[model samples]
Target chain A: MQQIDASAIDAVGIPRLLLMEHAGLAVVRAVHHLVPDPSAPLVICCGTGWNGGDGLAAARHLHERGHPLRVAVTGPLDRLREEPAAYARILRGLGVAPVECLTAEALGPLDEWLAECRLVIDALLGIGARGAVREPAASMIERINRSGKPVVAVDIPSGLDADTGRIQGVAVRATMTVTFGLAKRGCLLAEGPAHTGTLVVDPITIPRRLLETAAA
Target chain B: MSIHSSLRTPTGVTASLRNVLKRFERVRHLMTQGAWPEGRSVYGLPKIKQVKLKVRKAAAKEKEEAPAEAPATGAAPSSSSS
Candidate 1:
């Protein structure tokens, strides 16, 4: 899937940022479907990668649509990669400074914070993530699941393997998963169905032929 | 690869070969772009800059109004001391 995204960017000339935007929009739409109240508070938990980029982008859209929002990033703002960093910068420019919660100490207030949210966006991991989830992220996922709020996971649920549907230690039990492009094989097999309450396949701007090629 | 006579059932071999060819045909299309159509825009989003501006403006407005009010409440008590 990452290869297909790269091919779409390199061979098909689609900007990575545009794909992120589309992904974010798709998530916002799914959120709206689940939570119709415009003023309901939405918490988006982000990591440092492109999945976080999608959440940051969704935060902007949700904010625009009058949904109260808070962005809690797993690490320091400076640690974010390029595309996520760009969206985070823009979010800051809009005066929505994402809270950094990298340590257990920093995450101390998160459970209480999430308890009040109408919904949670789990942007902590994606298809590229592997192995067991480490600290702060692991703790954060625990907090999200415990909050008992409806969670909308971006791509696969943060801690589930995208190809095998195996849980990497603790995983977020999402109310819905807004996956990009095609649904991953993992989302359909094994523990995926139990963790992913609902699944949504959001379309990116990749050409159909490219996806067919990759699948073929 | 030579198939051993004992291992090959005539019908099974024909079916397996046909399936392999079908898969190869699909793979060939992916490897070579000659059969694919073109001219579609890969960037499908619209009014992105405008959306960003709106979000920024709204956030700035919220910041201005935040000072007059007590901190937004309803959050569970902080546990930072723990």
Candidate 2:
């Protein structure tokens, strides 16, 4: 899947930023489909990777459209990679400061946000995540599960093994999973369907040719 | 393997190798049973006992249990007579 995404970006000449934007838009669309009222509060939990960047982009879109939003990031802003950092900067410029919760102690406010919000966007982990889930993200997943708020997992649920459909230590039980490009194999594998509810596959504008070539 | 570890799904397929229920499954089961009500925290869910029912197979061997007065219908010819 990474190879296909790379080919789409590098060979097909689609800008990486465009992919992020499209993915973010797709998530927002799913959110609207679930909860049409724009004023409903929602929170996006993000990791410090492209997945987080997608969350930031979604935050921007949601904020622009006047949806009550809170964005929490797992790590410091400086540690964010280039693309995510760029989105982070844009978000900050829009006065949407993302809460950085690096430690379990810092997650207190996250609990309040989870309790207050109507939906959760789990951008904390993507298809690249493997093995047992570690701190902060693990804690966030637990909180999300306990909150009982319907969650819309970005790409795939955090802590879910995208290839094996196995739960790595713990995984978020999302009410709906809005996956981009294609449906990940893990979403259909063992214990995958139980955790992944109402799976929605949205194209992120990866060329059909690239997808076909990868499948072939 | 313990009976719990070899639990089967509704279709009679083995559910998983582990006897313990996944947290998600446990929580969902609790909710369905009304043990975990909505608005309650999901932490510290009560333990669910895995019930192992003793399935007794019905008495078998109709051929061996055939009545003494039964006709030898469709029975193979005796090789001793040949």
Q: How good is the docking of model 1, by CAPRI class?
A: incorrect
Reference-based lDDT, residue B43, model 1: 24
Roughly what TM-score does model 2 have, to 2 decimal places? 0.72
Segments of candidate 1 deviating more than 4 angstroms? B1-82
Can you give the lDDT of residue A144 in candidate 1? 93
TM-scores computed on chain B for all candidates: 0.22, 0.47
After the best TM-score superposition of candidate 1, give how far the Cα of residue B9 lies from its true spot, in angstroms: 47
Scored against the true structure, residue B57 in model 1 reaches a CA lDDT of 82
State the TM-score of candidate 2 restricted to chain B: 0.47
The residue pairs found clashing in candidate 1 are: none
Highest DockQ against the true fold, candidate: 2
Model 2 Cα lDDT, one tens digit per residue, B1-82: 6566455455542363235875556666775787754444434557887776543433334544675435464344564467
Model 2 lDDT tens row, A1-216: 788888988998998899999999999999999988899999999999888889898999999988888999999999998888888999899998898999878899988998899999999999988789988899999999999999999989999998777899999999998888767767865678788998887879999887766545
